[model samples]
Each structure stands twice: as C-alpha cells, then as structure tokens.
Target: MQLLALGINHHTAPVALRERVAFPLEKIKPALATLRSIWTSGSPEAAILSTCNRTELYCAVEGKASHETALEWLSDFHGVDVSHLAPHVYALPQSDAVRHAFRVASGLDSMVLGETQILGQLKDAVRTASEAGALGTYLHQLFQRTFAVAKEVRGQTEIGAHSVSMAAAAVRLAERLFEDIARQKVLFIGAGEMIELCATHFAARRPAELVVANRSAERGTRLAERFGGRAIALSELPNRLHEFDIVVSCTASTLPIIGLGAVERALRARRRRPVFMVDLAVPRDIEPEVSALEDIYLYTVDDLGAVVREGNAARQAAVTQAEAIIENRVDHFMQWLDARNVVPVIRSLHTQADEIRRTELDRASKMLARGDDPQVVLAALSQALTNKFMHGPTHALNHARGETRDQLLSLVPTLLRQPER
Candidate 1:
C-alpha cells in the first residue's frame, strides 16, 4: 500500500468550498469507517485532520489508482461535485505525503504561520482516529514522527515567535472597528478551545460585559466562570444579541447558528449601532449573509488572514530554519517508510530458508531410520542443506552474463558471509 495525503486547504480553496468539504468533529469517526469501506482492495488505514483552515485525510491504500479513489470518496461523502473540487484538491503520494504531514504538524501550513493551534488540532484528530481503530502501523508511525518533528521545530527554532494568534488578531480587528474594547460588550458563541482563547484575549482588554452562548450550558458556564463572565443558552442569543457591541463565534454546529435575520433583528434593536463580528468556525457559526448588512462589520477565518500574516515577513529567517528542520525529518520518515515497504520480501526470504532446513532434516531422519551410517548421514545432511540453501544464488550467478554476472560476482560473497565479531 502507498501513503496518500488528500485534501483542500485555505491555500487552494476558498472558505465556501472548504466549509462544504469539512468534516464536523462528531462525523469524523463514522466518516473514517465509510472511507475504509469504500476501498475494498486492501486493509486501508486512515486518519482525518480537520480544522478551521483545512480538512485532510492521511491514508495508507493499495493499488495504483488510490489517489483518484480517495478523491471520489471525499466528493461522494461530502456531496460536492467532482468538477468543483478536483481543481482545488491535492493528492500527495509517498514521500510527498510524508513531507506534507511534517510541514502541517510543524505549523508551516497554517493560515497563521507557525501558530501552534493546528498542532493541537492535529493531535486531537490522531487521538480520535486511534479511538476509532482507524489507525494502523503506517498512520500510527507517521503521526508519532509528525509530533516529534513539530516539537523539535518549536524547540529549536523561533517559528512560533512573534506570531499573532487568531485570538489576538480578532482583538486587533475589534479595536480597529471600535474606539475601545474596554467600553464594548463582547459576546462569544461557543466554549471550545478557540472560544476560550478568544475569551482570554478579549478579557485582557476588560470588556464591559462578557457573555458565552453555547448549546451546552454546563460548558458555557465553566468557560464564563474562568473569564469572570456570565453564561447564557444559545437559544437566548437573539433576545440578548443587541446588548453586545462585539460578537465572536466559533462552534462545531454544521449550520449557521446566527442567521442574517437574527442579526438584522439585533441591528434594528440597537438602532443602527455598529457590531463588530468575527466568525472563527469552519462551517461558520455566523451566516455569510450577515456580512452584507449595513453598519455590521463581519469577518470569517479567511478575512483574518491578513492580520495573522502581519509579522510573518519579519520571521522569514525563522521560517527558513523551520523548513530546514522539516526537510531533514521528512527524509528520515521516508527512509523508515521505504524500510517498511520491504518487510514482506524479508519475511518471504526467511520462510524460504526455513523450508530448506526442514527438508534436509527430514531426509536425514529417514536415513537414520533405515540404519544408515551415522557419520556419513550427518555429513550428507550438512552438504545437502548447504547445497539447497545456495542453489538459487549459485544457479543465477552461473547463468548470468555480462553486467548481471559481474553484479552477482560482487554481491554473492557478502550475501553468504556471516557477521564477524
């Protein structure tokens, strides 16, 4: 089987297309099962890494057409047209797959360059795959090394230094729209890690009122308590939406939680007062239509790209250093993958040798049962075993002509030699 990395990311596709192909957190395990079922040729192994910026499938599949097979599975599962997706999708095989995994884990592939959040997201994906029993030897080894390379990159280089996190960028954007964050009421929709990070950043600015709206009251309460804020049910958002001047949302909901109608109602209630909004979710918690409303400033994950990429130029040296580290690690991983590919050949060779030994022993046993001379039989058995073991190589060397014979002449002694102390 060959290793393949297939998906579309922010670099290759717009958020509209990306959100369509994204796998929700709860859907990942079942999606993995479905993907495994689609490839009937071999015992295919797969792990999916889905985040705000990308949704990637790392797979170990058999056959020459595995890449196309992966693309078809993705298209069918997500219900996206092949024509719309084929241009944006990248299917990386073998070493390219290894390299991509390493780069992604090391934060080189993030929208926010060198941001550490994608690494955590990747780990979560790997853990989920492990729980679903979707991981096998190939994927298991790939992620382990991917993590190690990330740790090494972060430890040895300044790739993450001077980076503007998504949270900080959101705050920066909010400041641009409003006179002061301290005077604005901030409403965060969701209690996931991204929400928590945004809350921490916004809380540092001391917003007048901080509220967390979530589907789960318990999780919202816990998150709210951490930031000295209050929690409310997501259902209550429409009634309370006008009270907040800033809204930031990141939720796992497949559909838009905040519709244009709700925002329009909120705007009417506020009497044309501007609301700066950030939607950090993949599928998006806030509606795309909300961005069109007058006096409303809305930004999606892609809209925040410019703010995140601000300090990247200054860190170009560090990026160069990180790239060097990833290259070395990718080479090492490919070497391991190459070694793994030959394992069956190694097993077959050992099996052949064992068969020869067993056959020679059985012949010697038969001779002893017939009352043959013990020393003669023993010598004959030894000779027979050696001849049988060497027959293939001896025949090949004798029959081979020109360059092939010359090659065998140089290789035979080393193949036959025992290790020296």
Candidate 2:
C-alpha cells in the first residue's frame, strides 16, 4: 500500500479557498468514510484534520490513484468545481506525505510557528476517524509516531519557549485596553479548542468572572466548570451582552453570531464602558461593523497575526536544527516502509522453503517405514531439500551477465547463507 497526503493550508491557499474546502467537525466522520470508499474500493484507512488554518486528508491505499481523483472528490463533496480548487490544492506521496505530517504536528507548518494546538487538533481528528471505522493499523501507527515526534521536539528544543502564540498575543492585545485582566469579566463564545485555549490563558489571570456561551448549553457548562465560570445559552447573549468587559468568540457558524445591534446594545448597557473583543472564528463570529463603534476594541484572526509575528526572528535560528531532525526521521520512516513493502516476497520465500522441507521429510519417512537405513534416508532428505531451495537463485546467478551478473554474484552468497546468531 502507498501512503498519501492531499490537502491545502494557509501557505498554499488564501482564506477564501480554505473556507470553501473546510470540513465542519460534525461532517468529518461520514466524509472520511466516503473518502475511504472512493479511494480504497472497500477497505481503506483515512483521517482528516480541519482547522481555521488548514484542511488535510491522510490515507493509505492499495494502488496509485491520480492526485486529481482526490481533488475531484473534495470538490464534489464541497459542491465546488475542480478547476476552482486546482490552484490551491497540494498532493504529497509517500516520503513527502510523511514529512508534511511531521512538520504539521511539530507546528512548523502553523501560521504561528511552535503553536501547540495543532497537535491536539490532529489527535482529535485521529480519534474521530477511528470512531468512524476509517482508521486502520497503518494510519494509527503513523499518527502515534507523529505525536511522539512532536512531543520530543517540543521537550528538547526552545521552539515553543521563544515563539509567540496566538492565545498569548490575544492576552497582550486585551491588556492594551484593560489595565488589569483580574478586574475584567471575560466571556468566551463557542466551546471549541481555540476558545478553550483562550479561556485557559484568560482564566490564569483570575478574571473577576468567566462566562461560556454556546449553542449547546451542556458543552458550554462543562467547559465553564473548568475555570469556575457559568454557562449561558447563545440566545441569552443579546440580553446579557453588555455585562462582560472582554469577549472572545470562535464558532464554526457560517455567518456572524454577534452583530452590530448586539454590540450597540451591550455598549449602551455598559454606559459606553470599553470592551475588548477577539473573534477567532473563520466566518467571523463578530460582525466587522462592530469594530467601528467607539469604546469597542475588536480584533480578528488577522489582527492577531501582527502580535504573533513579533518574536519570529528568534525562532528562525532553531529552524535549521529542527529541519535536520525532521529529515532524519523521515528517512528512517521511509526505510521502515520499504522493508514493509518487501514483506510479502520474504513470506513467499519462506513458504516455498517449508514446502520443500515437508516434501523431502515425507519421502524420508516412507523410506524409514520400508526398513531402509535411517541414516541414509535422513542424509538424502537434507541434500534434496537444500538443492530444491537453492536451485532457482543459484541457476539465475550463474547465468546472469554484465553488471547484473556482478550484482547477483554479490547478493547470492548472502541470500544463501543461514541467518546469523
């Protein structure tokens, strides 16, 4: 089987194209099943990772399939044309696929280098695919090793320590407006991983109060409990909008969840008290017009980019070392895969040798049963079995000519020798 990775991310595609190809979390499992069916005939292993920055598909398949086939499948699934996506899509095979996955898991491929959230996102994707029965031995092992490498890289290097994370940058931007984070009432909209991360950082400040609002009250409540906060339904936002000083929202909604009117009401409710808002959502949970309001400090994902770019110079020094490590790991993984590819041939050789052994042994047993000398029968059986196993390769090596003959001569002795102790 061949390993492949096919998708587009922040570097290769703009947000417009990324959004068009993005897979909502709920649709991932069925989508994976469908992808496996389309590519693998019946039994195939596949996983998908879709975040604000990227959407990727990793799979193991039986035969070579055109890269366009996967691209066409994605276009059809998203109800878009293949031509529209061709400019942004990237398809990597075997070693390139392995390297891409390692870079992503290690956060080298993130918009903000050394960001740790992608690792969890990748884990969640693997879990979902496994639950959907779309993950098998090959992919499960691949992801497991990917996670290990990510942990090793982070633990051994200063990659994360010197890098600026989006969450930390959000906190820095919020600090610009509010003198003390502890005095502010923080509100987080949506219970996804990004929101969860922002909440964790904000919670560390021990804000006066923390509130989590979501479409699902249960999920909201569960996340709220972690930070000593309360949960509110999404519908309750308009009435309670102005109560908080800071609002961070990241939802998968295709449209704005918080609009101009809502922020206006909140501003009026707070008597024009300054409010800090961070909208990490892709389609933008908070309307852009809300940023125009006085005393309303709003920042989108793009706005955070500037803040996270500050310490990138320090990270550049570590890039060479990290890349070397990744390259070595990639070569090691490819060697393992090459060994796996030859397993069937090795198994066939063993089976043929066993068959010859059994046939010779049976003839020897019959000679013994007929009262022939047991020693003579055993010697004949051993010689016959040895000749049968060596005949084909020995003949070929003797008949070979030119460079091929030299290569066979070099390999034949090793092939014929007993395995070392």
Candidate 3:
C-alpha cells in the first residue's frame, strides 16, 4: 500500500483559487466517499482537510494511477480548471506524504507558522473520515501518528511562542480602523471556533459592547456569556446591523448572509459612519459587493495573511527545533511501515512448516500402528522433519553463486538459530 497527499494550500495558490477548491464542513464526508469510489483499485481510503488556507486530500492507495485519479477527482468535484491548477498543486507520494502530514500537524506548514488552529482542523478532518467509513488502516494509522507527533512537537519546542494568530491579527487591523478598541462596539457573526477565538481577543481589549449573532441560541449564548457578551438571533441582524462599529463574520453559510442591501440600509441609519469588518468565512458571510461601499473597511480571509506574517523571524528558531523532531519521528514511522512488507513471506514460511509437520506425523502414526518400536518411530520422525526443513536451504546454498550463495549462507543459519534461554 502507498500514501499520497494532493492539494493546494495558501503557499502555492492565491485565496481566489483556494476558496474555489474548499469543501464545506458538511460536504467533506460525502467527498471522501466519492474519492473511495473513484479509486477502486486500491480500495482507496481518503480524508479531506479544507480550511481558510488549504484544501488537501490525503489518500491511501496501491499504484501510480491513484495519484492522477485523486487530482482529477478534486478538479472535477470543485469544477476548477486543471490547467491553471496543475502548477499550483502539490502531489506528495510515500515518504513525502508522511513528512507533509507530520509538518502540518506540528503547525510548521501553516500560513501563520506554529498556529494550533490547523491541528484542530486536522482532527476534525480525521473524524469526518472515520464517520464516513472512508478512513481505513493506512490513513487511520497515519493521522493517529500525526496527532502524536503534533503533541510531541508542541511539548518539546517553543514553536507556538510569540505567534500572531489570525484572531489577534484581526483585532490588530480593527485597532487601525478605530481610534480605540475599547470604545467601539463589536459584533461577532457565528458561534464557531474561529468566531469564539476572535471574540476572546476583542473582549480582552474591553470593547464597549459585544454581541454574538447565530442561528443556534444555545450555542450562541454559551459563547457570549464567556466574555460578558449577549447573544442575538441571526435573523435580528438586519435591524441590529447599525448598532455596531466593528463586525467579524465567520459562518459556514454557502452564500453571503450580509448582503449589499443590508449593509446599505445599516449604513444609511448610521449616516455613513465608517465600520471595520472582517469576513473570515471561505464562501464568505458578507457579500463581496459590500466591499465597494464608501466609509467601510472590509477585509476577507486573504487580507489577514500579511498581518499574521509579522514577527515570523523570531519563530524561526522554534521552527528549526520542531522540524528536527518531525524528521526523526518520520524516520521511525517509515521504518515501521517498511517492516510490514515481509508479513506475507513470513506467513507463507509458517504455512510451509506446518504442512511438513502434519505430513511427518501422519507417517509416524502409521509406523507405530504397524508395530514399529516407539524409539525407532520417534527417531525417524525427528530425522525426517530436520532433513525436510534443511533440504530447501541446503539446495539453495549449493546451487547459488557469488552474492546469491553468500546471502543464503548468512540467512539460513539466522533463520534456524536456537532461541536464548
């Protein structure tokens, strides 16, 4: 079996391309099921990890064809142009795939270096795969080890130290737009992990008021209460949109929840006051056309890229330490995989030995029944078993020449050596 990872990430593709290829949280399980059907030859197992920065497919397959099939499947599913995508895609095979997984889990491959969000994202992907029955032996083992390596890296290094996360970056950008973060009223659209993180960062600055607008009141209230913010129903956004100076939206909606018309109405009520907005959703919670309006500072997921990149030089030392740890672990994982290659040969050898033992026992039983002495029968049985066991190796060694002969001579004795007491 072989492991393959194919995808486009923030490093290789622009946000425009990455967004087009992204899989929604609900679509991932079905996407993995489709990949399994397409890669029938290998009884293919797969997982999809799609975040703001990446859309990756990790597959466990058998032959070279699975690699090409995976790429075509992704392009067809996303309806993206392959010619434009091919150059931006990275298709890693075998050891390279393993290394990529380790780096990703360790947060070394994140857009914001050493960010922990991707680890949670990766775990979610694995869970989706497992629920879909799409994660087989190879992939399950890979991700389990990936998580272990992630833990070791986080525990051993300062990789997460001095990191400027996207949530913090969003807050930083809001400070530039407003005179004081403490004086502005902030609205968070969604009660998901990203929104909660953004809420924590904004709440720390003591915003005048904070509100969470979500479809689920229970989830929304729980999140808001943590930071002394109140929850509001998403349907109430149209009437409440004019109340806040800063809005951060990151929901799983496929279409824009905050359309141009809604913003225009909100703007009219505020007498065209400037509002700072961050759209952290992939498909985007806010409409793209809203960005064209006057007195509005609108930023999408891509805008935070440069913001999070600041002070990365200080993280390089920790990155080096994490990479070293990942490299050593990857070597050990590959060695375990390599050791599994001889399982079939070992099974065949055991089968052959069992067949010999049964045949000899049958003959010895007949001899004893025919009134042969027990001592004679036992002697014959032992001699016969030994000769049969040695015959194949002796013949191989005698007929083999040069390197072949030397290998047999060394291997046979080791295979038959006595066990230690």
Candidate 4:
C-alpha cells in the first residue's frame, strides 16, 4: 500500500475555493464512507482534516493510486470539476506525505505559525475518521505518530511559547472594545473545539456570564459546563441574542445561523450597545451584512489574522528551531515506514525457513517410525535443514566468477545468519 495526502489550504487557495471543498463535521463520516466505497475497494483507510484554514485527505491505498488519482477522487467526491480543482490542490506521496502530515500537526504549515489548535483538530479528525470506520492501520499509525511528533516538538522546543494564537488574538480584540472584559457577557455558538477554545480564553477574563448555544443541547450543555455557564439551544438565540456583549460562533451549519435581521433586532434591544461578534465558521454562522451595522462589531477568522500578526516576529525567530525539530521527526517517521516496508520480505524469509524445518522434521519422523535410531534421525534432520536453508546462497557463491560473486559471498553469511546470531 502507498500513503497519500491531497488537499488545498489557505496558502494555495482562496477562502471561496476552500469552502467549496470543506467537509463540515456532520458530513465527514458519510463522506468518508462514500470515499471508501469509491476508492478503497472495501478496505481503504482515510482521514480528513477540514478546518477554516485547510481541507486535507490522508489515506492509504492498496493499488497504484498516484497523487493524481487522489486529486481526481477529491474532485469527484466534492462534485467539483477536476480541471477547476487541479490548479489549487496539492498532492504529496509517501515520504513527502509523511513530512507534510508532521509539519501540519506541528503547526509549521499553519497560516498562523505554531498555532496549537491544529494539533487538536487533527486528533479530532483522526478520531472521527476512526469512528466512521475509515481509518486503517497505516493512517492510524501515521496520525498517532504525527500527534506524538507534535507533542515532542511542543514539549522540547519553544515553538509555541512566544506564538500568538487565534484565541488569544480574539481576546485581544475584545479587550480593545471593552474597558474591562469582566463586565462583558460572552456567548459562544457551536460546542466544537474552536468554540471551546474561545470560551476558555474569554472565561479567563472573568466575563460576567458565559453562554453556549449549539444545535445539540447535549453538546451545548457539555461545553457550557466547562466554563460554568448555561446551555441554550440555537433556536433560542433569536430571543436571547441581546443578552450577550460578545458573541463568538463556529458551527458546521451551511446556512447562516445568526442572520442580519437577528443582529439588528439584538442591537435595537440592547439600546445600541456595541456588540463584539466573531464568526469563525467558514460558511459564516453570522451573515456578512451584520458587519455593516454601526452598533455591532463583527469579525471573521480572516479578520482575526490581522490581530494574530502581533507576535509574528517572535514566532518567525522560533521557526528555524521548529523546522529542525519537524524535519528530525519526519526522518524518524520515514525510518519507521522503511522498516514497515521490509516486514513482508522478513516474513517471507521466515516462512521459507519454517517450510524447510517442517519438511526435514517430517522426514526424520518417518525414519524413526521405520525403526531408525532417534538420535541419528534428529542429527540428520538438523544437518539437512541447515544445509537446505544455506544451499542456494552457498551454490551461488561457489559458482560465481566476478565482483558480484565476491560481494554476495561476503554478505550472504551475514544476511542468512543475522537472525540466528
């Protein structure tokens, strides 16, 4: 089987193209199953990582499916024309694929360098893929090691210490609006990791109240409990919207959950109180028109990129060390992959040896049954098995007449006896 990674990210494609290919969390499992049915031929393993910044498919296939095949598959799966997607998509194979995954998990490939959230996002993607029955041994190992390398990089290097993350940038932006964050009521929509992260950052400011609104009440309750807040169904947002001073929303819903009219109504209800809103969802949970309202300040992930640039210089300085760590880990992962590739050869050799042993043991048993001395039969069986195992190499060495023969003779004994020794 070969490893492949195919995707487009913020660097290669505009948000418009990225959103077209983006698989919302709710659709991932069905998409994976469909992909498996189309490409994996009943036993394919795939993991998809889809975020506001990137949408990537990591997979292992048994046949000769090259990078182009992966791209074509993605194009077809997304109902996008192959020609249209060809320009924006990137496909990495084998070693390059491993390297790319490691870099991504380490946040070396992020738009915001050393952003820790991508690592957790990757883990969640892997988990979701596994639950969907799309993850196989190769991808499972790849992600496991990818996560390990990320942890190693984070623990051993100062890569993340000086970096400014999107969550921190959001908090910074919010501080600019309110004199004191302690007085603001923060509302988070969608109970996913991003919302959890935004809640964590805003919660640190000791906001007067924290509210989690989600499509699923269970998920919303779970997330709300983390911040000692209450949960509200998304349906209640329209009636309760005016209560929040700061609203951060990221959901997989394709349509805008918070519309322009809702925000306008909320603004009027608040008596023109300035409201800070962050829409981290790609399709945009909050309508774009909401940004035009004078009393409501709205920001998307793209807007946060500007605020996230504050510590860029410090992060750039640490990039050299981070790259070195990622490269080292990539090399280590490749070595492990190389060892995995040789497993079948090693297994075949062992199988051949076992066959010889079985044949010789059968011959000795027959001789003993015919009343031959047990000790003599056993000795002959051992000698015959040893000679049989070494026969091919010994003959090749003795009959050769060139440097090839000399090289084989020199290496044959070591190759044949290494395991035994």
* Per-prediction CA RMSD (Å): 1.9, 3.9, 2.9, 4.7
Question: Model 2 off-target regions past 4 Å?
Answer: 41-43, 171-187, 199-212, 218-232, 238-247, 259-277, 283-299, 366-376
If both were scored by lDDT, which would come out higher, candidate 1 or candidate 3?
1
lDDT of each: 0.91, 0.87, 0.89, 0.86
lDDT of 1 by residue, 99-218 (tens): 899899888988888888888989999999999999999899999999999999999998888898899999999999888899999999999999999999999999999999999999
Q: What TM-score quantifies how close candidate 3 is to the native fold?
A: 0.88
lDDT of 1: 0.91
Pairs of residues at least 3 apart in sequence or in different chains that clash in candidate 1: none
Provide TM-scores for the models.
Answer: 0.94, 0.82, 0.88, 0.76
Q: What is the TM-score of candidate 1? A: 0.94
Per-candidate total of colliding backbone pairs: 0, 0, 0, 0
lDDT of 2 by residue, 284-397 (tens): 688889989999999877678788888777887566667777888889888988887789899998898888888888899999999999889988988897788779988887
Lowest summed lDDT window (length 10), candidate 3 = 61-70
* Model 4 TM-score on a 0 to 1 scale: 0.76
Kindly list the per-residue Cα lDDT of model 4 for residues 31-127, writing each as its tens digit: 8887676574536788899999899988888765477777877888778999999899888988789989998998888867888889989999999
Candidate 2: which pairs clash? Answer: none
Number of the top candidate by TM-score?
1
Q: Write the per-residue lDDT of candidate 3 for residues 62-99, one digit (tens) a residue.
A: 65635677888888998987887889999998889999
User: Which of the two candidates, 1 or 4, achieves a greater TM-score against the reference?
Assistant: 1
Q: Which candidate leads in lDDT? A: 1
